[model samples]
Target: MVYIIIHLHGRYFIMKQGLFHCEIGMADKLAMVVFSGTVDRLMPVGIIASGAVAMGLDVEVFLTFWGLNSFRKESLTSNTKMSRDYEDMAPMMMQLMKTKNVPSWFDTLKKAKEIGNVRIHACAMTYDLMNMKKEDLADIVDDVMAVGEFVDIAKDAKFTLFI
Candidate 1:
């Protein structure tokens, strides 16, 4: 006896007698465009990247504008402000996070990088515009890259998010 099985998308099939199995494909790469400098927006970027890493997915983060600003060595530790639209909730949110023992976004990203494949790229335009050097940014930043390069890297990603 012989059996054949084929799966599509998320569906799977199993056949007896002659063992055959198929499974759906999952996105192996996660591309993130981090454009915001605020803690509120940055937190999710880290959390999501961490989640992706946990699921065995590669993560690429392209930091531009305010996002690159937030990763500066001088700003990472001192930045506590949320988005302007949520300014009023900053204090409360901070308090809640502290109460819950939530780690900083940078810490989360670092942990993800340590355990999995996570690449952090700083925008070349932002680097030039701000007159910043590689030394001026956090150690987590893998390299400084042009938007075109980053776009090429992200174009093949199975999932992409802008934050």
Candidate 2:
């Protein structure tokens, strides 16, 4: 039989299975590198992080370049433009989302954080290059981190995505 023990919040629980021993703890981690700033591209990043968090995965988002710009407090709420390749469809898509009562991508990410472990990091280099201060970023950002530091965190993630 397999035996398993899990400790949480100072409590311990045990389980038995067939011929194996296991220790259960934190779920897998998911890392995402968000580079695109367009609404359409940014939408998927939030949605995917929501899904991962819902499935018990910890999510870390590294925002750089245009992605970092999109997270600026002033831009987060007012921006609605999509990728240039689909610029013609932006209006239609925005209308459809409004008609369907879809939540904004930033709101979605915020909700995910409320329900699970979701960390958002802004690239230090991008922050400096753009002459932006940490206060310029949305409150959702957990910290400003160097690329090397982020890479170290992401290197062992169960899965990594570039969006």
Candidate 3:
């Protein structure tokens, strides 16, 4: 009789523990993408980021090289030489973008900011040499950071991409 009681008690305890140990996928995933290039290369990333945000994914973007310039307020706002590689045509493209109301880089940025859980990080080394203050960047950018810090964040990401 004592053995029977003890066995029933043990079974109850096991079932109670199983209720608490049942799995639930409440944790969201992480995505880290490295970008370094012209708007042509980086714009597609913005589009993708917006889509990911729509799907409820957390996104962190690391912007370097000419891609970094895309986050600058002036670069987003005015018709300026965009990429050094396209010295001759950059200005023209910028103006054409402005006239079309097709949403300049600035507009795309604003949409991403409004709809997404997106964090834009500037490269710290580039920021210092470029004399760019945090305030000089677009309103959408979350912070400036080094590659090491970014990597640390990316370590547990569900997906990491380079663009």
TM of each candidate vs. truth: 0.82, 0.84, 0.66
Q: Candidate 3 — what's its lDDT?
A: 0.66
Please give, for residues 1-163, the per-residue lDDT of candidate 3 as tens digits: 1111112311222223334332223224455454555665556676777777778766778877567766777776543444567768866876686697656545665687688567788988788878899888887878999989998877756788887
Worst lDDT run of 10 residues, candidate 3, spans 1-10
Error (Å) of candidate 1 at residue 10 is 23
Positional deviation of residue 50's Cα in model 1 after best superposition, in angstroms: 0.5
Q: What TM value does model 2 have?
A: 0.84
Tens-digit lDDT track of model 1 for 16-75: 575655443543789999999999999998899899999988899999999999999999
Give per-residue CA lDDT, model 2, range 42-93, as digits (tens): 8998899999989988898999999999999999989998999999999999
Colliding residue pairs in candidate 1 = none
